[model samples]
Each structure stands twice: as structure tokens, then as C-alpha cells.
Target chain A: MEILTQIFSLETLSSTLRMATPLAIAAIGGLYSERSGIINIALEGLMLAGAFIAVVVSYFTGIPWLGLLGALVFGGLFAMIHAVVSIKYHADQVVSGVAINMLAAGGTVFMLNIIFNTSGTSESVNALPYWGPFKPTVYIGLLVVFIAHYVLFKTPFGLRVRSVGEHPHAADSVGIDVEKIRYICVGISGILAGLAGAHLSLGVLDSFREGMTAGRGFIALAAMIFGKWTPFGALGASLLFGFSQAVQIRLQGLGIPTEFVQMIPYIFTIIALAGVIGKSTPPTAIGEPFEKGKR
Target chain B: MGVDKIDIKELAIELLIPLLAIIFSFIIGAIIVYTFGYDPIETYAALLQGAFGNLNRFADTLLAATPLIFTGLAVAFAFRCGLFNIGGEGQLLVGGLAAAWVGTFDGLSVVVHVPLAVLAAAIAGAIWIAIPAVLKAFLGVHEVITTIMMNYIAYAMVAYLSLKVLANPGEIKTPPIEASAYLWRFSNILDIRSYMNLGFILALLVLLFIYYLLWKTTIGYEIRAVGINPDAAEYGGISAPKNIILAMLISGALAGLGGAERTLGLYHYYIQGFSPGYGFTGIAVALLGRNHPFGILLAGILFGALSNGRTFMNMAAGVPIDLVNIIQAIIIFFVAADLIFRQFIPNKSEGGVA
Candidate 1:
């Protein structure tokens, strides 16, 4: 009885929202790219890059907002490497995504060595201001979810994005620029994933550490799939993951091993993929390179 | 003679692409170093000296390369079956734990104990990937995501077992295995005081075995057929689902052998965080090697050299070791986007009419 009360407390709810914010934003970001037929396993890399950029910018400028902006721009720019390789060169999308991840993991630490002369961590910087009990990015994350749903479903641009992902040939025959739409969608994913990173470093923590994003980008990817690649679905999935993490934290002192708690979200993701909650399918042509004349 | 010449030329082009990608990645790495106010030549010279300066360093390189050879084979084998296995790390960890547990068994001879521990590791690795394999085969879930999720689960589970269940008092590692389970190190057999073990030779034999298996066996034929075109293979009576599961099991077994080598050959026990991304780096190794056994051997040695020498590069050249990772990433990028090479060597098939 006491455990149930502790698990359902207001503190857990607030922590859930805080943790879910980054995941929700990143899932929506991944949704944009995957819906446009580009597989983005690089969300983890983009978020890490964004976190490092946000920390460096905020450290230099003493402004958290500017750090957020820098992260967004850098995220989009970094994602273009993936876009050009997979889109223009017709490289295998998964291979390209893996390269992006390795680059970010290496590049961020390399830059840190040059800038801070330290390898493990950077100096503390100004963090994003809080609004009431939560940071502003938390609220912004909620807003982005609804806006993404409207833009992805209710708008013609969204229709084109969906059309390009589902059947690129049909969309191409109808005069839609398949490559262009894919590029924009991938870029948008980068921007949103960058926001997710900024939320981690600036909104949640104040300093940048090596490999600090851990596997949240991956969890966001799982959330995106678990949500069936829809914005609201992603939001709900993120909440479930966040709630598990919150409860995991709460159970740390209750004699339940922390590692067991940590396994919950990943286990849930595997179970979800196993068709326990119905079939979760991706966009039809998600990982294929777009060719104009090829059958 | 004309046919032989054509085959030779095609083989040359295939080999040339990876070589050029490596060279280009180094040039980019040099540029990045120069831009950051470091002397690229000095840094690379230091890196080379550190990697091959003496017999000891060379042995160290081979020692590091051993597990990579196994993990690289793991990834490459899965690629042959048209699967992306991002679960090598987890499989390796599980295998290590299994070997560690088996090594704890007392009163066994050297031959029986060693093979028993190794077999246990391989089986554990296969079992670890079984869930993802079954899901991918039956339900059509992409192995990429499923395997990655399995990796996280493995991390947590291993940490728990090592930290809470099997850990020695006040240490984050399991108890050392019995002497019977130890893989004979070169220090004991040869004059060199290095940790290089029989695992290096074992990896070489495994490489040859994989080559023979892939090129000579009917099972390998079916696996490759499925990888190239699953629908066609299925139409021809090949069981795609069966091959998918078999390929994953083999891949996982290879990864497990890597973990077993680390435990039985090097550490003699399972330690928390024993791997420094050997599994993840295997992806880079597989791609850069063109997913071939011999190619993987060379790529594994190169990566092993880089990893072995990075600390010296850091201390002697005043260059961060992370630069090696940057170069590795650039290598994978170039390898994946080989179309960039079209400018240097024009495509022969471009202008021919079908």
C-alpha cells in the first residue's frame, strides 16, 4: 500500500513529465525523418552533438537561450551529413547512421579536449530558467507534440511527407520532389532532436559530460516505433518510459536492485516489438534510397 | 587469359576502394589535427611509433586485435544473412558471464575445462540473441532496433550479475577462474612478457573456418541467397525464417567467443565494463573490411593497432586519444559513401546501353 502511494505521488508525476520531455521531442523528430522514408538511427548522435553544443555555447555566451539556438542549428547541420550520404550517394542508411553516431561520439570529446583541456567533463555553465516547477523546455516539448501532429496529419505538407515515405514512386510521378521532401524531413528531425539534447544539458543538467546522452536517443527511437510513428503515440509512449524511469529511481532505496529497475524500459520495448500490443509497422519504404528512374 | 585478366581487374578495384577510403580518412584526420593547432605529421609519427616501436607493442596490438576478430566476424556473418546485428555487445557480455560461471567449476582437466567454458560462452551468446532472432524471423520486426534494445538489457543484466550476484568482496569483478581454465599466455610460453595468448591463433583458425564455411558449404549458400534476395530465395524453396534464426545464432556465438577470449584468455574472470566498445567498433571493422573474412582480419589488426597506440599518442604527441575514434568514424563514412570515389575512377557501366 505504501509502495503504491509512493509510486503514484505528485513528485513521480513531475519527474515523469520532466524525463518524458526530451524523449517526446526526439521521437517526434525521428518521426519526421522516418515518415519521409529515411531511417535515422543517428538521433543518438544528434542529441549528443546538441548537448555538447548547448553546453559550449552557454558556457561562452552565458546565455542559455543562445545555447539552445546553437544546438538547433548545429543539429540540423550535422544531420545534413547523413542526408547527403544516404540521399545523394545512395549509401546504406543504417551504415550512414552508424557513422554519424561514431562521429558525434568522437568529435564532441575531441572538441572538448581542445576547448576545455579536459576529456571527461566541461565546466559548469548557466542552465535554462525554470517556469514554475519545470523548465520552459518541458512546456515547449508538450507544445511541439501537438504542433507536430497537426503539421504531420492536418497539413498538405504532412500529406506529402507521408506520401513520399509510403510510395516514393507515386509521389514522384505526381510531381513531388521526393529527394527534397526527404531532406527537409531529415533536417527537421535534426532540429527537434537537437532541442531534445538542449533539454538534457540545459534544462535538466548544467554541465556536459562525455557520452552523457547515454541511450536516450535510442529510447526515443523505440518510443517512436512503439507509438507507431505518430506524434501523440510517441508522447504517450514517452510518458510510459518516463514513468518507468521515475519509478525506477524511486525503487532504488526499496531493496530492488537498480539494474533491474533500469531494465524495465528496454524490456518493455522488446515486448512491444514482439506484438504484445498489436503490430507496430514502420513507413513502407523507410530505409531505401530514392532513385528517380529505377523500378 | 582474357577472363583471368578481367577477374583480376575486378578484384583489384574491390580491394582498391577500401585502401583509398583508409587513406582519405587519414588525410581528413590530418586536416582536422592541423586545424586544431597540432602537427599532423608529428602526431601520426608518434602514433606509428607507439603501435610498432618494439616487439612488445606489436604483440600488444595483436592481443587487442584478437577479440575484435571475433566480434568483426560476428557482425560480418549477420550481414551475410541480410541482418543488422547491433547486439554484439550484449551477446559478448552474456557470453563472458557464462564462461566466468563455468570457469568456477572445480576439479577438471585443462582440455575439458577450457572447451567446456568456451562452449558455454558460445551457447550463452546464441541464447542471448534468440529472442531478437525469433521476433525478426516470425514477426518481421527489424533486427536493428530489437538487437539494440537487447544490448541495453544485457548491460543492465550483466551489471547486476557482476555487481550484486557474482562479485568478489569489495571488488566489481567475479572471482578469478581456476588455473585449468586459463588460456596459455605468450608470457608463459614465449620470451615476451605480454598478455597475448593462444586466442590470437584461435581467431586465425576461426577466420579460415568461416571463409571455408561461407564459400564451400550449402548452408552458407542458402544464407547468402537469402541475404541477396529473400523473396527469390523463398520462392526457390529456401526457408528465409530458418536461415535468419541460424545466421543470428552463429553471429551471436562468434560474439560470445570474443567474450570468452577476454575472460578465459586475458582477465580470467568477468569484470564489469570489461569491453571498451569492442562490439561497437566491430561494426566499423565489418564495414571497412567489406564484410569478408580476410578483409576483416586486416581491418581488425588496423583497429587493434590504433586502440593499442592511442594512449601513447595522447602522452607522447599531446594529441587526445579521441582523435583515433574520429579517424575511425571518418573511415566508416568514406567506406559507406564510396560513390565519392566515382570522380577518381569513372564508372565503366555508365554509358553502355542495356
Candidate 2:
């Protein structure tokens, strides 16, 4: 009974919110990229870059906000490379995404070795300023989710983005610049993903570790799919994932084996995904490359 | 009369792009090395020596290539059926775990136990992939997301089973397999220091099997037809959904065999971190091979050489192993953007035949 009580405590709830914040931020980012019809599988790499850059800049400048800003800038720059290769050069999206992931992993480790004289980890710095006991950052992230939801369903640009994803040919025939929309959406996705990484480094751990993004990008992707790709739907999905993670952490404290607890979120995700198995559909042009001459 | 000349020109044009792409990437790699204050010639020389300097090194290269052949075939097989099986990592991990479980159990002869373990792995891998295939075929779910999601599930499940359920109690790994289940190393008889064994032969056999399966079978014809145009294939009396599932199952089975070979022939036990992204590297190998069995064999060896050389390069030249990864990234970039290279090399008039 005590163990059960501990599992359902207030501390667990707060931690759940904390864990869910980054995932929600990234899921919204995935939402934008998918809505615009560009499969942004590079989200993980972009987030990793953002986390590293955020730590480096913050360590040097002693300004967490500046670090966040640096992450946004660098994340966008990294994402631009993906855009150029995928959108402009017509590279396969999966291959380009894998390249980005490998590049990020190797590049970060290389830079760490050169700059810090260590393997793939950065030294701890002064802790970043917190948003207060209420944790203003969480609220802000939620607000962004709401804003994104409103924009996606309410605005004309949003409508154009969805049209582009569903049928690029039809969208182009209606005078929409499919490439331009993709560029903007993918670029913005990078910024949001960067923020998520920044939150992990500055808000959660106050340091950078190699491979720290740790498949959070993929988890966010799952959340987006499980949520049916809508912003609010994604939020619900992320919260559910967050709760599972929180339970895992709590179970770890209760003397139940940590490994078994760790399996909960992943197992639950697979089962949840199974629920939407044949019913859920992605955008029509999700993985297809857009070519002007092709019918 | 002029058609033959046009065909030759077109072939030359098509070949030129990939060649230039390779050269350009090598030049770029050289520039990066130079910027780091390393001599490109010496580094490359060392890389070559490390990869092929001795029999032991050559064996290491083959060992590395062994599993890649399986995973590469897995990816290529799915590509023929128009499905991108990104869940190779998950399938490989699951298959490896299954092999490890069966290999450790006692009371079976080597001949029967070894084959049984391998079969268990293949079946497990097939089941692992079947979920995504069913979703795609029946539920209209995009396999890209489903497969990627499955990877996370597989990773977690493997970790859990390794630590709690299947753990050897004292250690985080399972107990070693019985001697009968082990794939004997050729080095034992040859008195060499290399780890090369029957696994390489098995990989070659699998490659031959894949080639025959893809090129000589009616089912292969159905898969290709569905891949090229599912609607048309259905119109032509092929069952698109059935082929999709079959392709995934076949791909998973190949990946499973790769895992089995690793466990039985190489490690003889399952350990964490056994796969250093072999599944992902297989994607590049398959793409670079152009989905041909012989092409996959050569490409897998090339990648294996690079990976094996990186260890030697790290020891001899103080070059980081990460450099090899950078090379891989460059290769994938070039391969994925092959059209970019094609544009620079002017196409011949006869190339319009396609």
C-alpha cells in the first residue's frame, strides 16, 4: 500500500510533467514537418545538436537564455542542411535523415574529444535559472501547443500546409509554393526541436551527454502518430507517455526492478500504436519526393 | 545502326556520375583530414594497410561483413517489394535474443540445436516485422512510423529481458551456449589468430539464396510488380497486401539469420551492445549495392573494410574511429543524392530510352 501510495504521489506527478515537456515540444515540431509533407526524421539529430550547442554556449557565456538562443540558431542551421539535401538535391529522405543522425553522433563526439579532451561528455556547469516553483516553462510549452493547434486548424497558411502534404500536385496547381512551405515548416520544426533539447540540457540535466536525446525524437514521433497528428492529440499522447515514464521512475524507487519499470513506456507505446493499426492514415505524400515533371 | 553507339554513350554517361561522386567525396575527406593537420596520403595508406595488411586483419574484415550481408539482403529484399523496412534493428535485436536463449539451453546435439536456434531467431524476427506489415497492408498505416516505433519497443524489450528475465542471475548477460550449439571457428584448425568461421560461408549461402529467391521465383516477380505499381499489380491479379507481408517476413528472416550467425559463430553468447549499428549500416550497404546480391556482397565487404580499418587507424595513426563514420555519412549522402552528380555529367541522347 505504501508502495502504491508512493507511485501515485505529487512528486511523481511533477516529474511526469517534467519528462513530458521535452517530448511535447518535439512532437509539436514533428507535427509541423509532417503537416507540410516533409518527413523530418532528422529531428533526433537536430535535437542532439541543439543540446550540445546549448551546453557549450551556456558554459562559456553563463547565460542560459543565450544558450537556448544558440541552440535555436544552430538547430535551424543543421536542419537547413537536411532541407538542402532532401528538398533541393532530391535525396532520399530516409537516407538523408540517417546521414544527419550519423553525422550528429560522430561530429559531436569528435568535437567533444577536441574541445573538452574527453569522450562524448561535457563537464557540468552552473545550473540554469529555474522558471519558479510552478515551472513557467511547462506552461509556456503548453501555450505553444495551443497556439500551434489554433494555427494549424484556423489559419489559411495552415490549410495550405495540409493541402501540400495531402496532394502537392493539387496544391501547386492552386498556386501554392510547395517547396517554400516545406522549407518554412521544416525550419520551424528545427527551432522547436532545438528548444526541446535546450530544455533537456538546461532545464533538466544542466549538462550534455552523448546520445542524450536517447530516442526522444522517435518517442515524440510516436506520440504524434498516436495522437493522430493533431497538436492537441499529440499533447494527449505525450502526456500519456509522460505518465508511463513517471510511473517507471516511481517504480524504480519502490524496489521493483528498474529494468522492468523501464519497459513500461515502450511496451505501452507498442500496444497503444496497435490500437490505431489499420485505422490511422498518414498524409498521402508523406515519403514521396515532389518532382515538377512527374504527373 | 546508330542505336548501338547511342547505347554505349548512355551507359558511359550513367556510369560517370557515380564515379565522379566517389572522387569528389574522397577529395572532400582529404580536405577534412588536411584541416586537422594530418597528411591525407599517409592516413589513407595506413587505412589501407589496417584493412588488408595481414591475414588476421582480412579475417576481421570478413567477420564484420558477415552480418552486414544478412541485413543488407534484408533491406534490399523489402525494397523490391516497395516497403522501407526501417525496423531492421528491432528485428535483429529480437532475433539475437531468441538465438541466445535457445543456444544456452542444454540437451540437444549440435546439428539439431544449432539449426533450431537459428530457426527460432528467424521466426522471432519474422513475427517482429509482421506487426508493421499487417498494419501497412490492412490498416493503411505508414510502415515508416510503425517500423520506427517498433524499434523502440524492441530495444526496451531486449533490455528488460536481458536484465531481469533472461539474465544469468549473477551477470547482466546470459550463460554461454553448450559446446554443441557453437559454430566452430576455422582458426582452431588453421592455428590462426583470426575469428573467421563458418558464419562467412553461411552469409555467402544466404546471399546466393536471396539472389535465387529474387530473380528466379514467381513470388519474386509478384513482389517486384507490386513494388513498381501496387494498383497495377492488383489489376494484374497479384495480391499486393500478401506480397507486402511476405516481403517483410522474408526480410526479417534474413536479419534473424544475421543475428544467429553473430551469436553462434562469433560471441557464443548474447551481450549488450553486440550490435554497433550494423542494422543502420546495412541500409547504406544495400543502397550502395543497388539491391543486387553480388553488389551487396562487395559493398558489405567495402564497409566492413572501412570499419575494420578504423580500429587499426586509431591504433597506428591516432586517427579517431569517428572519421570512418564521417566517411560513411559522405557515402550515404552521395548515394542518396546520386541525381545531383548525374546532372553535372551531361547525359547522352540515348539515355532517354528509360
Which regions in candidate 2 have their CA more than 4 angstroms from the true location?
A1-4, A134-140, A252-278, B1-21, B348-354
Candidate 1 docking category?
Answer: high
lDDT of 1 at B94: 95
Full-model lDDT for every candidate: 0.91, 0.81
Per-residue alpha-carbon lDDT of candidate 2 for residues A1-295, written as tens digits (9 for 90 to 100): 9987887798877888888888888889888988888788888888888888888899899888888899888888888877778888888888788888888877777666656767667988654576665344577679879989988889999999899899999999989999998888888888888888888887788888988999888878777777778899888888888887888756667676665555555555555556734344567787677886478
Worst 10-residue lDDT window, candidate 1 chain B:
B1-10
Residue pairs in steric clash, candidate 1? none
* Predicted structure with the largest TM-score when compared to the true one: 1
DockQ of 2: 0.59
Query: In CAPRI terms, where does candidate 2 land?
Result: medium
What DockQ would you assign to candidate 1?
Answer: 0.81
Superposed by TM-score, candidate 1 places the C-alpha of residue B251 at a distance from the truth, in angstroms, of 0.5
lDDT over C-alpha atoms for residue B195 of model 2: 79
lDDT by residue for model 1 over A129-225, one digit each (tens)? 9899999999999999999999999999999999999999999999999999999999999999999999999999998999999899998998998
